[model samples]
Target: MLVYSFQGFSQERPLQQSKELPQRTDAPTNSQQPNNPNQDNNEKGRKTLEPRPISEYKIISVKNDTTHVDTALTIVKDYEFNYLRKDDLHLLPFTNVGQTYVTLSHTFNTTSLMPLFGARARHFNYYEVEDINYYHVPTPVTELYFRTVFEQGQNLEAFFTTNISPQVNIFIGYKGLRSLGKYQHILTSTGNFQVGFSVDTKNDRYHVKTHFTAQDLLNQENGGLSPQGVINYLGDDEEFDDRSALDVNFEDAENILDGRRFYLNQSYDIIKKNDSIQNNQITLGHVIDFTDKEYRYEQSSANEIFGEAFETTNLRDEVEFQEVNNQLSLTFSNAVLGRIGGLIGHADYNYGYQRVLIQESGTIPNRLIGDVFYTGATYNNTIGKLAIDGLAKINVSGDFDGNHIQGAISYPLSIGSISASVSTNSRRPNYNFLLYQSDYVEYNWFNDFDNVQTQRLAFDFKSKKYVDASLTFTTINNYTYFAANGIEVDQEGFENPVTFNIAKPTQYDEQVNYLKLKASKTFEYGVLGSSSDLIYQNVSSDDEVLNVPDIVVRSSLYYKDHWFDKALYLQTGFTAKYFTSYNGDGYDPILAEFYTQNQQEIEGFPIVDFFFNAKIKTARIYFKVENIPSLLFGNDNFVAPAQPFRDDVIRFGLQWNYFL
Candidate 1:
């Protein structure tokens, strides 16, 4: 079904102001001047200067919620110490650092109103506007993240931010990774560069944030293992202990995804309210976003594994998608009414290949170009101890038909918080599913699909004293997916070589009901502690269009203590993750998408890892041994149909922060 883990909600929340830190002036006072002879000698104080608190450095989200920088070395920090710099509890990485991840879970809440571009697998590390974070700091701050990759490369992310003036801030950062994997023709290289600035007017009447990002993700694909290689790998033969010795489908194939984006958001106060009084305030806001992206796959020669091609050599498939959007909004806020806003937006999108394709069956159009106008409203308010938020949007006039509505309510409990939400969406499928042209003759397709409609209701409870749990129920109509049509070949000498297939887009005409329940908890006893997360899912459908594991679990046990007279903090732990067996989706390197397959059921296996982490001052170091179980018991883990999991490996990394 080409389903992957969609993280986070699409709804925008009300921006919250952060508590201001005490301002410290760098200029010396007249009394402290060396020429001031009247200054008391005793005032030449021997007091030691204390460093600024971490809370003075703020990180701001697109929604305007602000949080300070955290340098602490906690278990959560250890979990986030990876190539993506995010917790991978619900994800499984391939052998290389910059490669795509296998989604162990899925979330349906999406923010984009338009159809997304293709190459969905390569976009996990791609940063969107909402993924970017702004910053405010008392002084210049620098952060560096470094980790070792598979074979001969390293992954690093460096960021620096400073305030140009009291009201202006700027930041620049770059994350780069290059990994030569242990397997044949599986190298990955990627980079992301971002520069941004924020400005606030002295009168507090105007505020703006702008950023530009350029990114490229490249991977050399081998189309997984050949049949003989799979047989050798499954046989656990000692001669093939070295992965490089194994045979791959093809060696001269690669794909690249590159994009550039410019974003700007600004707001002006039309009716300002004094801080000392309780009154209504009004603001006018505008946002502009533009992005141009392309995905290309090239092969030295057409391989028989993917079927016949129009041309046998030097095959290339490329697609492009460009979009620009502008929005204007007016908001009013009060102590009682909280905040209410209305917005109108216009979007222009163009997606397709360079030229139209003329085939015997029909003529495939080269482009889908259109403009859309949409209007939406947002409301956020607090009545007594309960908070409420709602958003609704619809396409007023456009070639595309889409709409979204969401509502949420939350209440603070004595220990934690309880929240409930409901959301519904109707949108078109991705552009790739609609129209595509490839060098392979069987890969060309054009289809008119209906808008996919979905609805979800969820409840969540968060607390440390009690278990953190969530329950969600969702229903989907017009589910679209990719399926394979197999073509068997009979050879005289070969014992029925692996079957080749042509993938096609298909839609189910029935409703799918899905329910999910998840829970997490942590327990501590002296210096030893354990944390666990469990998920259970059930899917009910008349047709098998969607598939996922029924259950997933991750648990970790650790010991923490301060060593060397509290000079260093240390934490050591072991984590294990497991899921039930299911018909895992197969990956298509040409399209860079996962397609549904039921030929074989992949048995779930547990992946165990050991980690040792230590914190000294502002630097955190990590050492880990991943996939320990694979080392102890022969290697039999596979993330996809033909993709094998990573073997045991020792890796280390560090995160350091500097305040200047």
Candidate 2:
């Protein structure tokens, strides 16, 4: 582990000042003295001061971990220069910006006690409570990020924060993107806006924090490519080089997801004591959260690709979800007991369509509305050289029953730290699995499903001198997913028949056992360095329901040095990634979800990119040529079924910070 050092500041006068000079007896009184022209004095006769060290600017996480602003250029910073502003090692991006990503990995660790809203693809950029951060800085700070997109637009994020007083801080931020893809009818536009503030009392006994967010993600869906389009894409003909020239399944369909949220968290210390006097304290905390979201799909005319629909023109389907949650907690802390806390929470939710669907065989209700009460406990302690943490939660009264328990222990060694954890969770499936309604004839259904249970054990080791590695084994029972029901038919085209599958919700009856191991290491010699990341996964089940590639690997070779007499830091690298061929999942435009499919075996191919990054002062610049291999080979790589990967292109971006 790497520990950062922070510079400290003090307000005390210099000791040499008292011994060097003394005030004369005839000198004017303090108020009668003339002020310096360069000095800025407050109403209280104090000079305005600005922080000189970056450590004075703090960023606080939900768990209260504090880290300062960093302005260094490193390999980790280069990997996170994408639209998502995070490392994309375990994810596959779509051809267009602001689009969904294909998941290449899975982790079963969770603390949520309620079923999630469906349309997970749209939630990739959604900001939840845990995603938000609080800031405490001595002066105002601003950050700006900009990047180029595929064809016509750009992506940008702007953030600003300032401290009004020693106890109050506020911030506002917005991220927006607009991109017209190389293909027809695949444009994407998204926006996210957030504003928040944090305040504490003069005595530091009480604190309050609150935030509000509004977000919208919209995509013009063309249902991938038509059968002929796929043929033309793979043929690599010069005439069809322009993707817009190719045909598509439909051109008049689109989907939109919009949401708004308000959150508040406050804490008060009732009994406080200094650690030197008596290491004992008691605190009370409360949290309130509210969210409202809607997902809508619209088409000007119905298309036969999705089967029959009720209306031929002006077809639309929409669903809404709203939730409100409140929690109260009490905690006790001591030198011997560490920290222990208990909490009780209540959640009220409403999810469904606007009207019921009355069919010949059955009737589907309009909505599912209910209230749930839950209780949970948390503990953290350190004994000798080992640290232990545990949490347990269960629903006491609710329409659905769910429980979660997790525990972990970690110990530090001479070079690094090693940790082991175990967790078990039992919860209902997502809202869409239990109930859904759509205009398409094959898309409406309601069912009663059993709770899904999952148990996992994991071990991890972290060391910069050695290697970072982790292994996890998980078992899942009553797994639920979306799959397709295919129907083969002969068309008028001059070739073999084709198959079209309609997506539907389903649950697997047997248990699935899965194991994953990932390791990464870096070696540096002089100015030349090499880094590699590898992942191995295996699945055991009676049926071919769960599928993943057996091997995934990424390697990078780079050169780093300071140029212009150490004023500019530069790094140039080549990165290559590959995975074994497997049966990849298929995407559905109507449901905005990926379903299990075994018909098409997607072949694995290597993708290589060249990047040049540099840091000058408080700015970081990035330049990359993405998918350089595609320029020399055939266009056969696909992120999903019939969805070709992006072509070779040059992209550039930059991040800059300002302090005042």
Candidate 3:
């Protein structure tokens, strides 16, 4: 498990290709990108970051290869299985979410405006997958583990305004929210997005305005897992494994699992105004928003154990869900007639919902599902001039929703510039899989297909100082896959009538493509600074998302400045990655027979990592030493621990601020 990465860090261009800075058009533009290395502002409103003082300073961002770039196409560990996996195994599972925003302003005498208060808190944590130890067969036990999740929310806002004479101003606000503490929200309420006003305008215009929003979150605690107790706890581990002559293929094998959650929301708005076009100013709006959801499921399993060595069944049953939405709008603007030009427009309406709760534990399991609520309409536009700008958007929802469109264009031509864009994207399906009900009961299969889609086409380019490029293509439809196995039979006349078990179902229709390149260069010779990246990936898994390695490549490098007089500031970096197989299609025969029961594909090696960053000023100190040339993985199934190959941290801090 030491798959590839000798050295070739070059891949960093992709923000929708915005035209790698030469000149090409698809129309839609505005330019302003760069600045924000650490956020700094001078003059009198002074602000700074990294020089310390943001509340005792302490911000550590770590992803250690972002879960191996989402599992570099299937397992590649062996520093003795990363020291024998287990510790919330996550070869790739994201979202350790975090959000913080606080604003307070009061200045009725400085500019004729005051009264604005804000508080926003968002927290997210998802850590599921407990007890999964598979040393590739042969009595390697470790099961019965599930129940690990957590989600949180809190929000409050207050508002006021003045300066009705400058163009026209008005404000009003009220928002309160709370969602207790739990892992996997089922329901939790608190809502608002209200704004009210009356207006009369200038600059050859007429206006009228109104707005509304309402949201709900109650009973949020849908922490799933009870499908017949996960199919009788994996059918008691296949009734105590130990089959004779080996020949297992119960449709890929998966005992039992479950999940469900619900939520609802509301909204409304109306507007009228006329300023016929020029730089651009037109408004005609009528919009509304609404949403609802509810889901549930139950399952069971059993069929062979001890006798022919383990056998069980239960896939899923118990489902319910709902959803709805509507909107209509038309807007055109000149960005308050700014330093040149800018314009925009919008229109909208859509609704959808579903319900399914096929249960059978304490009753209710007769299969009664429901669906019907697919509506559509949407449009957007933008225009700008000076540096340059152009943009457009279109959306059509219903019949599983999704009919997107995009356009962009930008040209700075001086202070070193370039931009480009092209788009057609759509990704939907996840209201908990259109209302859940999944099961496999250890080897007794069943399935219920839902509308699934992933359509994309993208191109981007940029050049402000250096260069950047990106390309993407995707196609996916009605994709749903599942596999499991476990079979055993026994009967010796008398009372033994018949009892054998196994399951099956593997869904598909997928295609993926990607190409990226990024570059950053700034060097006066010494104290140097350089950045580079290049990546390419391709995948076609009609076999269904598994060990997807279609192809991959990654790169990285960095150098820093200062040593003495400047007190001390140093930085260093190095990284490399590459993966291949798909079409040349390899691996994923049920995770290669659950790890080498056959079906090969795991021959790619070369791993490397190195890091160093130090600073001493305001007592700032940080030391890092990761995979300094170890490229681990020694087997034992792999899950982490090749001498911590990475994740070495040493930091100390100090910061002070003064303002009264």
Model 3 C-alpha lDDT per residue in residues 1-660, reported as the tens digit of each score: 000120111112222222122111111233443344233444544433221112211111111111100111011111111111231111211111111111011011110010000000111111111111001110101111111112344333333322234333333334343433222222233333333333445542444433333332222211121222223323435442221111221212221111111211111222223446345544544333232222222213322321221224442222322222233334444545322212221212122223222335322222322222322223333344323332332233223333334444555555544555444434333332222223322322223444444444444455545555555555555543333332334444325443221223344555433323333333333555444344454445444343434334444455667668755656555544434432111111111111111132334333444545453432223233333333243211111100011112222222111110
Evaluated at residue 528, the lDDT of candidate 2 is 93
User: Could you tell me which residue pairs clash in candidate 1?
Assistant: none
The 10-residue segment of model 2 with minimum total lDDT is 1-10
Candidate 1 per-residue C-alpha lDDT over 540-635 given as tens digits, one digit per residue, 9 for 90 to 100: 998666778999999999999889997788889998989999888778889888788888677899989999999877788999999998778878
Predict model 2's lDDT versus the native: 0.85
* Positional deviation of residue 292's Cα in model 2 after best superposition, in angstroms: 0.8
Q: Rate the local accuracy (lDDT) of all candidates.
A: 0.85, 0.85, 0.28
Number of the candidate with higher TM-score, 1 or 3:
1
How well does candidate 2 match the true structure in TM-score terms? 0.92
